[model samples]
Target: MDLSEILIRPIQTEKADILREKNRTYEFHVRKDANKIDIAKAVESVFNVKVDSVHTVIRKGKAKRLGRFESQYPDRKRAYVTLHSGHKLDIFEGA
Candidate 1:
């Protein structure tokens, strides 16, 4: 997969922020078909950081209903990338 297509977007929840601050880890939404290696390389190249490890999770979509109609959201893949010491990505800086 292309580097640009591997990572969809960064996740910015409160929990994610805590992880970033404490563990030097960042979370991102990634393509479902992308693997751990791809995610690690993409983060390193895009953010110019040294990635120590990468963990991924697949979140199953839940069904939602509105006035007798029901639909399910698309499944998503999330990647947690931990940077090596002294390597930081200023993704949320000044935001």
Candidate 2:
């Protein structure tokens, strides 16, 4: 897959920010079909950082209801990319 297609966007919740600050890890919402290797390469190429490891999680869709109608949110895939020591990505920088 193309690099742009592999990574959807960065996940910038408070928990993700804590992980980034304390563990040298960054979180991203990636394509459902993307794997660890694809994620690692994408992060490296896009951010110019050396990735030490890549961990993925698949979150199942949740059901919802509104006034007798039912629906479900789409499933999502998340990646936790850990960078090598001394390397950091300025993902939150520059606006």
Candidate 3:
């Protein structure tokens, strides 16, 4: 898969911010089909930082009801990438 297509976007929530600050880990919403190696490569190339490890989670779609109709949200995959020591992405410095 193309590197650009591997990572969908960064997940910038309060919890994610805390993880980045304390654990040197960054979270991203990635393509459901992408694997761990692909995510590591994508993050290394995009951020120019060495990646120590990658952890992934797949969140199942939740069902919601509108009146009598019910529908499900799309499934999402998340990756928690841990950077190597002495490396950091400036893009998230002010975040």
Q: Write the per-residue lDDT of candidate 2 for residues 31-85, one digit (tens) a residue.
A: 9999899999998898898999999999999999999999999999999999999
What clash count goes with each model? 0, 0, 0
Candidate 3 per-residue lDDT over residues 38-74, each given as its tens digit: 9999988988889999999999999999999999999
Better of 1 and 2 by TM-score: 1
lDDT of each residue in 2-89, candidate 1, tens digit only? 8979999999999998999999988999999999999998988888889999999999999999999999999999999999999888
Ranking of candidates on TM-score, top first: 3, 1, 2
Candidate 3 runs further than 4 Å off: none
Model 1 pairs in collision: none
Q: How high is the CA lDDT of each candidate model?
A: 0.91, 0.91, 0.92
Collision pairs in model 3: none
